[model samples]
Target: MPEFAEEAEVTADAKRAVRVAVLARRRASTADQRATAAARVQAELVALVRRLRPRLVAAYVPVGTEPGGPDLPGVLAGALPAGARLLLPVLRDDLDLDWGAWTGPENLVAAGRGMREPAGPRLGMTAVAGAELVVVPAVAVDRRGLRLGRGGGSYDRALVRVPADTLTVVPLHDGELVDRLPAAPHDRAVRAVVTPTDGLRTLNGKPGVVPHTSAGRTGGQ
Candidate 1:
């Protein structure tokens, strides 16, 4: 195989290994643990939205054992400034993410991959570019901010449209933040990460302390 092909194979193998390990740990977590993790993530996200006050924010609903929990969309909806809109992803047939307005959790419909998505008009793939803050899902993220996604490449493709100045973040379970992960040439580096135990940490800067919010409770019910 060519050197480039060999490198791609190695990176793919590394990503698979990390994804399996991280997902196993997530599945082993108890219900109580998942709930606690969700609350912490909600707190950090609320603080971020309040501080940034982005006119348009993009986020996803947490499915299965993913870090932010099932009600994450609603939590973000409650946190946004009045008139600011929250955009949720609509997974296309080719695994590309299209954007849609998040009315509330009640408006979400079942979609492919056991995910819940907003039942609204599609805003096209480039819609993500308009978001000042974009929060993506990750099986794991490294200290350098390279995210190991679930192998779908959906967010990877969606991220390409994000402007250079936009803040892209990934939410993770406490242990999912690691020293390193394999990075391919096409992989995008996110600016920051939020974890259940660690609050928020910017890869290229000092860790930020986000105050815990009672606001995390707003749409949690």
Candidate 2:
């Protein structure tokens, strides 16, 4: 067997194991615990937008057992600048993502794989390039900003269009921020992380500067 092939198999197995563990822990949490985490996370998310004041923000609807929940689009819109836009992912048949405006949860439709997507016009993949902030959904993020996703290559493809220093962020449950994760050559590094407890952190280890928000903090490596 090729050396890299063996390593690839190991990485795939490790990624699957991590996803199973995270989903199981999320499923085990009580309704109240989940609700509390959601509220705190929502607040921090709003703070991120308000502080950065980005013209366009790329975000996602949290699927089942994901930390943020379905109403995340509303939270993002609430903090947007008067004319700013929130772009949601529209999954393409090829597993790449198209973009759409976040009208509301009511405007969402049931998409394949138990996901919800905006019903607005398809804005094409290049729309992601307009985003000054990109909030990706990840199973976890290591200190180096390597994100473990739910086995889909959508975000990995999307990240390729994102400009360097675009303030990409991954929102994870507190325990999901770890020291390291399996990385592939195509993996993208996020500039920051947000959690229910830790607020926001710059993966670079510098104190993240978010204006008008005291919730930002540097988390453990």
Whose lDDT is greatest here?
1
Candidate 1 residue lDDT tens string, 1-221? 99999999999998999899889999999999999989889888888798778899999999999988899888887988999999999989999999899998778999998878999999988998999889999998887778999999998899889986688888888888888899998888887888776667777443442323343421110
Quote the lDDT for 79 in model 2: 92
- For 68-99, candidate 2 gives per-residue lDDT tens digits of 76688888899999999999999999999999
How much is 130 displaced in model 2, in angstroms?
Answer: 1.0
Provide backbone clash counts, one per model.
0, 0
Which ranges of candidate 1 are over 4 A from the true structure?
205-221
Which model scores highest in TM-score? 2
